[model samples]
Target: MENLKHKARKPLALSTIFLRYFMLLCGGMLLWLGLLIGTYLIATATGEILPANYVEKQIAAAKDILVSSPEIRPDQIPSLSDYALYTQEGQYVSGSLNREQAQKAWKAVASGSKGGIRGYYTVIQREQQQEVLLLSYSIVMNYRSEWLRTHLPNPELLGIILIVTGLLLQIALWSYLFGKKLAKKMKGLQSVIGKIQNQDLEFTVQSSGVHEIDTVLDSLDTMKNELKASLRQQWEEQQARREQISALAHDIKTPLTIIRGNAELLSETAQDEIQRDYNRYILTSSAQIERYARELIEISKTQEGLKLERVTIDTASLLEDIEELLRAAAVEKEIQVHMNAHNMPDFIAIDKDLFQRAILNVVMNAVEHTPIQGNITLTAEGKSDSVCFTVDDSGGGFTFADLREATKQFYMGDRSRSSGNHHGMGLYITQSIMLRHGGQLVLGNDEVLGGAKVTLEFPLS
Candidate 1:
């Protein structure tokens, strides 16, 4: 790509495209005019077109005959083409010329002009005659060229129409070719935009040959590379962070277990109420530390990856297993755990361990938030195409920020996991599990409980 960019031609201005179109149009018109004039000249040179003064010359050859035969009438003079007779004073006497032509011709004759509107006329007069003879013929061909079939009309006007039509066609063809090329390049540019928007950066960049379009494409190619590098770097950094957390969590569990074992031994020997209270605090704090370390490992595992081992199990059996875990988590806090399942399917296909773990995580999050001895409710219901499990806690409901962002990775609320700093992966992990199961996790406030409600929608297979 770097080499290609260097090889790319400098971009031409947009005005250049318009200029080319303008030149083609003007050039076509000039060509049309030249072709029309050239055709006429060729026809004239070959005598296919008559001379302008054809009738006038014929009239001159007949003048001596009319002068010698002085008794001939005004219309009987010899001529090869149309002519008109006029009184010496310029009043019409008539032959083939119409009133309009006779009037224009008389002016030409009187002024000694060789031509009238579209034809040439020559006047012949006798010394003793009462009328003047005007011979005239059209210079603009009133008939087709001699080489054309007699059935055809005059070539002059028809040639103009045909040439103009051809000019328009030529110009249209040029415009279409140019427009097609432009559209192809634009489509290439559009493809680049689409791929970048979708973050698909693994394809070759197609060159458009055009200097301007290729320049823009080259820049976009560079941008795509930069974005890919940034994304990969972020991914690598995230993987390292998760590995570090997982290692640290694993390291902590060994020492935590020793501390808990030592606390249990101290508890067995306590004799006074004050000494008993001190021993109870050590055991309880140790247990809490152990749970936090376990959570840290769970968080890293969730981010790294989890494989689903789906198995079919009865709904009642699944619920029974979850009940044991939930009550065990809440028993020490004196929190009341109410659970029920209604309208449930006979069985469901799911990864039993992961599914139960996700449910436990949600309950635990609620347990951490609820005041000691507070109430928590779990309900499961069968839908037309899904099984929904809802957990509602009678603790302060989700704040606005939590409602919007609680499921995002590592989004600890202002009050959430207050004792477990940097430990807010429970809901995120649950959501990830739900997604992997082709399901959804919905979070909202429970109006009845006046606390946070989490609904897990599991699509049934």
Candidate 2:
């Protein structure tokens, strides 16, 4: 609150900048207006307009022209707008003015009116003759040649145009200057935001030359630094934990192998049936523990992504191994396991251990869901550019929820199909393996078996 109060007490510099620009605009226009008026005054003072005696002076000068040419043609008269010779009866002889304009001028001369046909006029007389000389001229200020006078606009209208055009130009100039300043500051902010959006947080945030935008940039920079540190720390911890679990699982394998070997030897030397049963129990339990340890190590590897070691193996041999392992898994349930290994590639490239494990996972899942005496079919064949292995079990088919989410990690299906022992990692592991081998896992209900059908497709090339 103290900082806020101190900052608030300071006057806004942005407002000062705006006020300065506004004042400059007003002063500039005033200066331009004054310049126009001053230039016009200087020109006008230098005999731009004739004095009041100009009409009387022109009349006195025209007496000689009237004596020399009684009938003055328009072209014969010099230094006048128009000229005409008229009798005492007001008849036009020759002049630049039309008959109507001449009559209007004649009326003004006869009645001594103050106004005539839109210009100044004067008349000259010779006392011995009945002829009269009438001359007409515009009373406006003169400048430029006759062509320019006829073509150019009047001074007042031209001044108004210049002032309006200058005002518009000033408005555009000031707007560009103000917008360019604001855009410069905004561009700095946009650059920082763009870097953050592109996931590139390694940059130095600079001032935007504005208090408000700089405030935002400060906060954003703080957030970026904090987020980067948090991500680095999180990644380090996760990596350490995974490494520890993998090493622990690997360490357990050796002792577990020793325990299972001792149990197997004791079972072979059993003298009583009860002792044999106890030996069998120890062997079975140890085997389960060993399998769990192996899966734990593999799962840790899979959690990131799996890497495959492809080796050339006979397709028939691979299928026979899968069939034997799957049959052993379903022995307790008394399920009939059948294998169809026809029309397959003789030798195919595959990761032997990983591929067998993926096949085992799918079949083990089927065994768990299938009832006793149920039949499980295994099909192996090549189609197009891929080798496909499909497992179908004679049991209840997969529900819609299972179809959609069975392969997702930790997604245990409905209790009716999953039972109590199933942990929902079988299909997930199989899918990860398939993906590593550039393949895909497909799930559906088999029409013939009337149970879940799982197909694993591995690319041949």
Candidate 3:
């Protein structure tokens, strides 16, 4: 916020830089036009206008002729044929004009020295000289004005064309330079944002050499550092928790094994049916407790993510293994467990052990929820970019509320639907495994099976 205030108080260099370039363009265009006009004038003066010494040469020739013919009168000078030659006093001794109007023409020509159609006059002194011949020439129209009128088109169209051309050139030049510069800087910033979005904080943020952009980059770098620290702390804490859970599960495993063994022995040796029933209950309960402990340890061990050792396994072989693993539990419950998969990949790259665990948990959850003689269908197939596994059981489908929270850790279902010692981490751990393998777990009601359906999708390598 303080930086924003400082920025507000400071001059905006971006606009200033653009405006400076624009001014330069305007000034440069004006100078170019001026130069073109100056060049045109010089060209016309040299190529179209009379020479500077034209009057001098004409006066010299006239004087020579007059000196050679002494009988020639001044009025009959015969030198001024189509031109008006005169003295400084405005007296004419030339042809093509009357004496009455010589003064007016002379005055007009003398007043317009640097403009109009008139040329300079020459004064020559003779050997027996009493008077001098003041000689000059004039054109029908002023060369400068004629040249401008001949070359220039409509004023309005000229202005419009010049303005449009300048704007187009400015746009082109600005795009080539300024636009490219901004895009390059912005693209670098975008890349940094993308990396941060991907949770990759291992890169450095480079300065853009622009003050405002550099400030933003500095803020992003600081945010990246803070996020990295926070994520590291979380990972460390989670690792510690996982290790503690694993140690606890290990410590309890031996006691649980001994208790289950003792109960089984009691059940076999007891004579009374009530006593045997009690022993059987203890045995089953101890076994369930041990299974829960093992599952807890396994889930905690891979809390962070699975370290997959991927291999190409045949789909048929994998399905067969799953069916065999769950066959005992399904038969005990009198549930019909069927495998229906076709149009699947021959081989898939997967961590066979982790994949098996995920499949087992999903199938076991279905088995626990399904009633006796219920149907459980497991399907696997290849999709466009992934392979999918679906487990659907013929039992009461999940409630809407359960559908939303069923995958959460330790979220057990209702008492009637939940299995003994089951705390609802099965789907959670399954989801974790699927995510670790770059897949997702989706839960819903199966239309065909009319029960809860769990779909696991894995991306193809």
TM-scores, each model vs. reference: 0.67, 0.62, 0.51
- Extract clashing residue pairs from model 3: none
Give candidate 1 misplaced runs (Cα > 4 Å).
1-4, 8-11, 17-32, 49-140, 145-156, 180-211, 259-304, 415-422
TM-score-sorted candidate list, best first: 1, 2, 3
- Model 2 CA deviation exceeding 4 Å by range: 1-143, 146-161, 198-204, 229-233, 240-244, 251-305, 334-344, 365-381, 388-432, 441-455
- Candidate 3 residue lDDT tens string, 1-461: 22222333433456665776678777767765676567546754674433334334555667676545444355544232234455445567663445544555566556754322234443333335343343444322222345553686433344467767766786678657777877775776798899999999998776654566667877888898899999999999878867876887888889888998787777667369757655655675566557657766877866544566789998789888777756655876889878878688888999887787788788888888788999999888888789899999988888897889989966887876676756566888789889988999999998887899999999998
Backbone clashes in model 1, listed as residue pairs: none
Best by TM-score: 1
- Candidate 3 lDDT score relative to the true structure: 0.69
Report every candidate's CA lDDT: 0.77, 0.77, 0.69
The local lDDT score (0 to 100) that residue 38 gets in candidate 1 is 93
For model 3, the run of ten residues with the poorest summed lDDT: 1-10
